[model samples]
Target chain A: SQQGEEDPQALSIQEGENATMNCSYKTSINNLQWYRQNSGRGLVHLILIRSNEREKHSGRLRVTLDTSKKSSSLLITASRAADTASYFCATAGGGGSNYKLTFGKGTLLTVNP
Target chain B: IAGITQAPTSQILAAGRRMTLRCTQDMRHNAMYWYRQDLGLGLRLIHYSNTAGTTGKGEVPDGYSVSRANTDDFPLTLASAVPSQTSVYFCASTAAGPNTGELFFGEGSRLTVL
Candidate 1:
C-alpha cells in the first residue's frame, strides 16, 4: 500500500496561471517535502515543511502542511513552461531509525506557453 | 558540485542476467538511498543507508539488493532481472542531521528487461 497519494493525476495550464497539487498521507510524519522531476531526469528538492510548520515559501513555490488532515498542498505562482514537470510529495515517518521517505504517485503538471 | 552521478544512463538486459546499478555522491553525505520509478507508480524506495557500512530495506526491496561499502558509493544489484524490474532507478544522498533531510539525486538509470 502506498503511504502517500496525490490528487489529479495530470494537470495542464497556461503560463502565468497558478498550479496547485494536493497530497494525502496515511500516517504521522516528522516532515513533508516536495520534489520536481523533469522528463527522464531525477528528482530535485523544492521545499520542505516540518510537521510543526503550517506553511512555507521559496521563490514562487508555496507549500502547506495540515497534519490534522494528513494532507499537504504545493502551489506554484505565475507558472512557466519550465515548471512543467512531475511533482511528488514525500513523507518522513515519525520514530524508528528508518528515516526513509515514502512518496506519492505525483501530479504531472504541464504548463503551456 | 557534481552532486550525485549514476552509471550507464540506460541499459537493456535479458531476464536471467545479473546487473548492478552504480550510484556515487560527491557531497560526502551520511545518508544514501536507491529508488525505482515506474510509470504511474511514482518513486519507491528500494534500499537505504543511514551511513556507510549499514543498509536497510525499504518499501520495495524484494528483487533488489544494495551495499554501502564506503561513504561515497551505494550500488544496487539485481540477481535475476525480470520484466517487472524494468524501470528508472535514482540515487539520492542527504546530510547527517535533524535539520538536514533534503535529498540530492543523480540523473537516474533507465533499465529495460527483455
Candidate 2:
C-alpha cells in the first residue's frame, strides 16, 4: 500500500516562479523525504525531514513536515528549467532505521524556461 | 565514482524465464533495497537487506528473491518472469540506517517481460 499521497498531480510554472507540492500519509513516519527524478532516470535523494523537524532547507528547496496532520510540503523557490521532473514523497515508517518506506504517486513539476 | 551500479540497464525476457538483476554499492551502506516502479503504483519495495546475510521482504515480494552475501552486493532474482513483472527496477542503499532517511539509487534496470 502507498503511505503518502502527493497533491496536484501536475504543475506548470515559469522558471522564476515558486512551485509547491504537498503530501499526506496515512500512518506515522520516522521521517519524510523528497526525491527528484528526471525523465528515464533513477531518483536522487533531495531532502529529508524527521518527525521531530518542522522544516528544513537545501539550496532552493524547502520542506516542512507536520506529524500531527500527517502531511508534508515541498517548496521549490526560484524554479529553473532543470527543475522539470517528477517529485516524490516517501515516508520511513516511524521509529526504526531498517524499517521500510512507502512512496507516493509523485507530482510532476514542469518549470518552463 | 562512489555510488550504486546496476547491470543490464534494460532487458526483455520471455515468460517462465529466470532473470537476475545485479546491484553493487561502494558506499558501504548497511541497508540495501529493491523497488519496482510501475505507471501508477509509484515505487513499491520488493525486498531489502539490513546488512550482510540478512534479507527481508518488502511490500511486494511474491516472485522475487534477494540475497545479501556481502556488504557491497545485493542481487534480486525473478524465479519466473511474467507480463505483470515488467517494470523499471531500482536498487537503493542507505548508510544512515533507521536514524536517517537518505537513499542512494542506481540508474535503474528496465525489464520487459513478454
Candidate 3:
C-alpha cells in the first residue's frame, strides 16, 4: 500500500499565480521528498525535508512539513507555463530500509500562459 | 553527466515472451529501484537494490525480477510477460545512507504487451 497520498488530484492556474499541493502520510517518516515529472519523461528531484526540519525552500519552491499532522505541502510561487507538470511526494519510513520511498498518487498542475 | 539512463525508450512484447529492462547510473550510487506506472494507480515499486549483490521486493514485486550485479547497473526482468504487466517502467538511483531517499530517475520505458 502507498504510504502517502496527495490531495487535489489536479490543479490549474494562470501564469504568475501561485500553486499549492498537499500530501498526507499514514506512518512515521524520516524524511519527505518532492519530485516533478514532465509528460512522458523522467522525474527530477525537487526538494527534500527531513522530519527535524519544519520548512525548506529552493528557487520558487517552498516546502513545509508538519509531523504532528503527518502532512506536508509544496508551494510554487510565480508559476510559469514551464511549471506545468506532475508533482509527487514520497516518504521514507523510520524502520527497516530507509532507502525506499513510498510515493503518493501525485498532483498534476497546469500553468496556463 | 548522464546521471541515469534507461534503454529502449519504448517496446512492444508478446505475452509469455521474456523481456529485460535495463537501467544504468553514472553517479555510482549504492541504491537503485524499479517502478511501474499505471493510469490511475500511480507508480508502484517493482523491486530495489540497496547496493551491488543485494535485492529486495517493493510494493509490487511479483512477476518481476531484478539484479544489481554491479553498482552502476540494475536490470529488471519479466520471466513471462503478461498484458497486465504493460505499463511505463522507471529506474532510479541515489547515494548510500540516509540520503538514499532522494532518487534520481531515468526517462522511463514504455512497454506494451499484446
lDDT of 3 by residue, A1-113 (tens): 88889989999999999999999999888899999999999888899999999999999999999999999999999999999999999998743344788888899999999
Candidate 2 regions exceeding 4 Å error are: A94-97
Report lDDT (Cα) of residue A84, candidate 3: 97
- The DockQ scores of all candidates, in the order shown, are 0.58, 0.68, 0.60
The interface root-mean-square deviations, each candidate in sequence, come to 2.3, 1.7, 2.3
Model 2, A1-113: lDDT tens digits are: 89999998999999999999999998877889999999999999999998999999999999999999999999999999999999999998834546676799999999999
**Structure candidate 1, residue pairs in collision:** none
Q: Which of 1 and 2 is ahead in lDDT?
A: 2
**Per-residue alpha-carbon lDDT of candidate 3 for residues B1-114, written as tens digits (9 for 90 to 100):** 999999989999999999999999999998899999887788899999888999999999999999888999999999999999999999998884764458899999999999
Off by over 4 Å in 1: A94-96
Sorted by lDDT (best first), the order is 2, 3, 1
C-alpha root-mean-square deviation, candidate 2: 1.1
Count of residue pairs whose backbone atoms collide, per candidate: 0, 2, 0
Q: Please write out the lDDT profile of model 1 over residues B74-98, one tens digit for every residue.
A: 9999999999999999999988476
Q: List the candidates' TM-scores in order.
A: 0.97, 0.97, 0.97
Please give the distance, in angstroms, between residue A27's alpha carbon in candidate 1 and its true position after superposition: 0.3
TM-score of chain B of each: 0.96, 0.97, 0.96
